[model samples]
Target: MAQIDWETLAGRVENAPSLLRLWDALEDYAQACRDVGCTEAECGLDLRRLPTYGGEWTGEYLFPIRDDGITIRSHDETHMLLDRERAEPRYVVVPRSAYNL
Candidate 1:
């Protein structure tokens, strides 16, 4: 399958009428996660299929994870634009380390 266009996907989120408010909320959540050594964070709105319909919104924040001089590469799945069922108005911030997993 073709990879989802994250830049374009982000654009969708950036275009929301309440972008600033939403962004601030996400940033606060992400900062809290980062303070606790979190690696990634994301928020997703009502999603059920590809080419999201109305009332759909999504956002993501990724932080570099370093371990032993190695930086783990990761993508934010919450901002993905694929056909899938995602509950509306969901906010999740993964505040943990993968290196210990």
Candidate 2:
């Protein structure tokens, strides 16, 4: 019934032991958050159950939909914790408009 703690969730994913598993966790958690946000359910828990078993993990953040042929520069020098499923420079996009010129 309680809302998810996404910040805490992301931190866990960012520090996951395996980037592949991290990608999975981030993807799942983010998607769950998106679904709950769209539905606006009064009882958040009623939505898809948390993907992780222990309370340390928040299974609700999905991978970001990035633009194709675009380069992302982290002004803050942030690093990417990518996996085999990492987004590519020329990856797929949806809604058409999601792709920028």
Candidate 3:
């Protein structure tokens, strides 16, 4: 069985007082989630192998968001997740010319 740190995640900084702190907290959680996919029952799929933004934009991230089955795209797309609880979908395009970036 894979190990998931519920402690560090329990007291997450979802709404910290500082911007840096918030980003740092978000980045931490993003990295952790990327490292270990969402095990939340809210996410029925196994996304423990998805990629998270590493504070860099060199490559692209093309993974599926478990909460609503929306495609998460990075790399020049600058995609964002909106109303994960909603069913409406958004588009994320990756240009063929991005390979050179």
Each model's lDDT comes to 0.32, 0.36, 0.39
Better of 1 and 3 by TM-score: 3
Q: Put the candidates in TM-score order, highest first.
A: 2, 3, 1
RMSD list, candidates in order: 16.4, 13.2, 11.8
Candidate 3 yields a Cα-based lDDT of: 0.39
Q: Residue-pair clashes per candidate, as listed?
A: 0, 8, 2
Better of 1 and 3 by lDDT: 3
Candidate 3 error regions (>4 Å): 1-3, 39-101
The runs of at least 3 residues in candidate 1 whose Cα sits more than 4 Å from the true structure, single-residue gaps closed, are 1-17, 42-101
**Candidate 1 C-alpha lDDT tens digits along 1-101:** 45434444444444434433334443444344445564323333222111222332234212223332222111132322211113222332231233331
Alpha-carbon RMSD, candidate 3: 11.8
Check candidate 2 and list the clashing pairs: 26-61, 27-62, 29-59, 29-60, 29-61, 30-60, 30-61, 30-62
Q: What is the TM-score of each candidate against the true structure?
A: 0.26, 0.34, 0.31
Give the best candidate by lDDT: 3
